[model samples]
Target chain A: MAKKSEPQKASPKSLDVSELMRDNDQPNFLNQMQEDFKKMMIDKQVLQKCIETFLDEIIDQLTLGIIFDLHRKFKTKAYCLEVKENEEEADAEQSEELPLSPVKSSPQKCVCPNCAQQVAALRFARHLAKCMGLSNNSRSSRNASRRAATNKEKGASSSSSYSANSDDDNDEDWNPRMNRKKDKSFSPKKKGTPKRSSEPDLAEAINTDTGETDEAKNLRHTRSNSSSPDSLSGSGNITPKKRDKFKKMGKGKERSSASTSLKFD
Target chain B: MSGKPENANGRVSMHLDVNNGLERVTELIETRLIESGWKDRVKLACREAITENNQNVPSVDHLIEVITPKARALVPDAVKRELLHEIEMIFSNIEKGGYTTTLDG
Candidate 1:
């Protein structure tokens, strides 16, 4: 055999060479190589196990991280969507109500006659009064007096004196017409002989009468004349003939004055 | 018996060097894991390392691929890159030696 021939050839060499040949035997070499291979495989397995554990840990972390990120993103998206929906709903409600607003507001809008500007109806009365230079208090008082006067005129004649008294009590600052009316009503009571009053008193009455226009005086005279003679006699006792005489005299005076002015011209 | 004492001694020293390097790598990894709030993961990895079958262990490249996204999620881009570089450097350093012995030394 080749192996036996090799050992016999080595046996002729030094002892060290035989020992080296024995040590280099195939079985022993193969065993050593096998042992080395096993150790290498074991080491590789150990290293692989360590890496696998580390990688598994990393994978777990990555999965958890991804899940957490998705959760946060979903939560934010949901919140944003909810907020957007609420805003949209509110906008829709406002849009639905918008059509009715103009109709409801139309009556509430008023145009100021003085300024020609649109104002709220609730404020228009105050604005108008202010535009007319009337304070709130004065306007209210004026309204009250006007109401009182209308009430008095609708009542019986016996209530005239009470009306005057009420007017005097309410209106300490009476107008010129109110003063004249009070004077005329009170004058009849003071002067028992109404027709025989002094010339100056008559002139004063005429002057006061000038406050009425000529047409108004004529209308008043015609109304008095048309009244029943019994009512006239009962109120004043002045003869109709005397009233006619006074009228003729007044016409003659006016005619004389006009003729004199014509001759002078 | 035929091997030189000096060669055996060199081999032993190289083995010790490799062990030390591995220990350093493990310590660095543990420190980073703890700092990044992966303490539970570290415990789980240790358990898995002990319990898993040898054949089923994952490769270094696969492990890196799995870890990249996780690290990216935990740290800033620059920090992630730096950590990955550091891990790669450790592996490269280890790889310079043969799989079984310190060929580089």
Candidate 2:
């Protein structure tokens, strides 16, 4: 324990600052400081060099990236321009060839008669029907307006004819040419009405009103004249006493025809 | 060395553990770059270079060169230095084992 204590005491005396200063330790301390400075400078230079190299690497990478990006952008732009140019050239060629071709280039379209609008041929019928319906509505509105005007102008005289005229107009809407024929035939009936009030003449008038053709009217007239009770009984197809019954049957047929015509009127 | 004997199995396992650690570090870095939106730009640079050269694989130095600027831009100086140090350490270890790293282009 004494020996350990003696070493401790000796260590303190060896570290005496005044004694070391008297022996001229100042130069040695300065030299040590200079050496430390040199080492620090060297360390600083090394660190600077490392930082510069890192920065240079970063710059080189950035430059390479920019170069690659520019190259790709230019390549894509050139490709797009080429494609656009090719398309333009194709269009120009087609336009030039169109006039040179022999076939007439009429557009596939039709004109709607009702509206006078040009439409594709495939849709023409549908468009025409729609336009016609529209026109029909307009015509019906016009007719109603005209009826109002005529009612104000001719009041009582026009009322009786108005019903017949409206019916004729509706029939004309379906077949204008047939209505003209009916109008011509109707003129003769108006003239002939005072001349007869017999059954055959009444039947003929009913047939005309029903718009029967001249041939059908003539055939009906021949049948009515030929189908007498005497002729039917002479043929002996039925019993002789049944002649009166046959006459009654002919009258029934005429009545039925009259009823059908009345229904139509 | 203090805890266990330096056997062949131990050496192989250490190497595998180091490789796994390096892979995880790389994944973390990639995730950071993607989050920063720099991954696509780096990948584009690498892709263009690879395609122009008609290369199937890129050198590690080339990949680092293409990615370093973007990495520097996205990461702080201290973090960038730490990341570079980690990458250097991984490369040094791989070199020490005489292993070559192959990256697909």
What pairs collide in candidate 1? none
List runs of model 2 lying over 4 Å from the truth. Answer: A1-223, A226-265, B1-29, B52-63, B74-105
User: For residues B13-99, could you state the per-residue lDDT of candidate 2 as single tens digits?
Assistant: 223232344246545555544565554565555556546655244554565665566545644456556555654455345445643
Could you list the chain B TM-scores for each candidate?
A: 0.32, 0.33
Tell me how far the alpha carbon of residue B63 in candidate 2 is from the true structure, in angstroms, after superposition.
4.6
- Cα displacement (angstroms), candidate 2, residue A74, comes to 21
CA shift of A205, model 2, Å: 9.8
> Each candidate's chain A: what TM-score?
0.21, 0.21
Q: TM-score of each candidate?
A: 0.19, 0.24
Model 1, span B1-97: residue lDDT tens: 1211122222222222333553464456555656766544433443343235444444434444554454434443443445445644454454555
Q: Model 2, A1-265: lDDT tens per residue?
A: 5323422432321332223223342324323323432342346444344433443343344445544554554445653476589999999999999885744555478876643557877777655554444335543453344435444545454666766755544443334334346445766436333323344554444434434454554455456666554233232334545744755564566666765664564
